[model samples]
Target: MTDTLIKLAVQAQFRTRPTLRSVVAQMLTEHLQEKYPPLTLPVAQLRLALPREGGGRGLSPLVEVALDYLASGIFPDLTARDGLDAYLSDASGTRLSFEQNGTRHYDLAVVEALIRELPVIVQVGFQDALMAYWNMPSDAGGSRWQWFAGILQDQLRAAAIRQLAGDVPALQRINQLTDYPARETRSQRHGPESSLHAYSVQTRLVQGETQVTVQSSDLLLVDGKQVWLCNLSGRIEAYASLDAFGQALGSAHGRPVYRRQPHLATL
Candidate 1:
């Protein structure tokens, strides 16, 4: 009865909004039904095979399976044949699977759980980031799914860093001064004489009726052989050394006077 209801719901949806993909999927299912008996798996059997972390409430496994079936038919190219699963497995630690009936499934629960753990501001920021990525021209990248996975991973990493550093006084001061909802700081060493240190910030501003959001990064490259300051105004300044960058930051006009003020009276 559950299987019959799910098929009826999907069929009704297709009738309301018919598309080439849906028509093809219907035809395929019909053709397969002629050769083999329909599988009547129970709802519990169709639930996500992986165990969820916190067991948070979300869409029923049956609904998730239905959506997965629809997505598989609509986006056939993103399946194993197109290498999306392989790319995502390596890049984002996410995997996609296929059921016996050929429906493709991914761990939507995991993604939803991660997003739910983030702060509201971070959630909004991630939405904006996704929209911007979606608006990019087709020629800008090869696979939209791959780019999207990358963006998700980046946001998750930033959010995790912010959450872990929430109690650190120095990081709190930096966050307060930058006015950025989320920030990521990292230092890495590569080979003998090469190193990199960077602070990336994300913020939103309102101008008239328009709201603008931007991301900027201050980077020290190759063990301070060079410094790059990317500002919210979309300006990039390159300096030969840390000292040069410090001088520019200190003397630049229109700089916030309060930034130079010492937080402690002794300083």
Candidate 2:
């Protein structure tokens, strides 16, 4: 049986299947649980200390002595208050709002400020993920997959930091990546101009239900007659002709022994 491969540019982030945000949250949660076991803290209390929540421990007489000092240090714009809860309430009330295309958007600078106060572990995780990601060359094969994976790793790192700062027993974030679609860049190749036009190519063989897919990122012009396909997370494959590339792809995917239609540019 032969396989099929399709390639196309998605308006959303690359790799639309398997949500990246879910993957990221999963990684971070796993990391945290590994480091800190036996989750027992109440969910509400955990929310108070998380980075996105501003690392506020909520109301407690024991926290009052340090409330003024901490609130002033964390929320400089906040005024002095008689109690910790009052101070947190005042800080929470402070918000930044803006309108875009008649749509209202709120910026939680105060919440982000708390993220900055996360412990060193979270900070280190973020830094490491970033370093690994940035180190990868954009032109390399599978870089796009790496890019998506890296972004998730970074997000997880950030979440982990929030979890640590909040003293949360566990991380709880949903993967809503599918909500965002892949976008086209100015230099993105498409249609006849694109060497590989399908966002994802799939072919099936006659004998079985197995399908073959080629995550062609871009086409590299080796010469006037030769071209190379940069796969998503694989090595570059050289094709003597576009027709040959299609045939090979079909064969790989278990396509029948026949002249395969080329999945390439019009040229």
Candidate 3:
């Protein structure tokens, strides 16, 4: 059932982005001659995120499978209690007491219980990290999984850096604006050596009672006003002035920001 659903989903032609729920609904309706039970929404979501027990099935959710693989393989001894306690430990093995800034953000017991109950929700991309490890090419030598794990670990660490450094609002804004997958591909010139970071943003502006939308992937340095919107890959996107960019972000209430649109059309 899972394999058939995924195959049909991949084959289905659509004008918009495909969602797991929509695919599953179509499958149950057309293929299986069944209607999705109202109470099964949570189960449906969970099944979409998890792979079936044992192997040989094609097109399983890689993320959940990765978590299961990690639980059984790398940390074979892990139990519910172990997962709960594991969340409290930092990279240096120091136990976090949930007492940062002399204020507690979460009850330790509550968080521990949550972790114990839903271990997969602890983090994302476990399957991606695991796949990178398993699928490492023969050319790479000496602890390939370790290298992959290290990079994945670093990315996870970076995501939490704001919370670690006590910049909660910056982290919140980042999470808010970056609802879609971030542009992970980095250019050599735009790497860590430079202070600039690539970002995608949609800015809605009101021009004489008409709503205009500006969106781009080449938007480097997202800090409003002082932005380097130019595409460094010789595309020559935009290098708008501070006030011009600010106005783009300062639209009236109830206006929706688009994901992206043509550059020249926005202008």
Error of 2 at 161 (Å): 34
What's the CA RMSD for each of the models? 22.5, 22.5, 22.2
Which ten contiguous residues of candidate 3 have the minimum total lDDT?
42-51
* Per-residue lDDT over 155-215 for candidate 3, one digit per residue giving the tens place of the 0 to 100 score: 4335445232475644433333233223333324234343234445665554555767766
Writing each residue's lDDT as its tens digit, candidate 1 over 1-267 gives 243553564354334343333333343333323433333332223333332334421223433433454445321122232222212121223333547667554444433333233333333444555554455543336445444434433443343344435545333332332332222322121223323444543334444566555543432222345444544322345567766655554453774432321111100
**Clash number for candidate 2:** 29
Better of 1 and 2 by lDDT: 1
Give candidate 1's error at residue 45 in angstroms. 38
Answer with 2 or 3, whichever has the higher lDDT.
Answer: 2
Query: What lDDT would candidate 2 get against the real structure?
Result: 0.36
Supply candidate 1's per-residue lDDT for 186.
27
Clash number for every model?
A: 0, 29, 0
TM-score of model 1 (CA atoms): 0.23
Over 4 Å off in model 3, which ranges?
A: 1-116, 119-217, 221-235, 250-267
In terms of lDDT, model 1 sits at 0.37
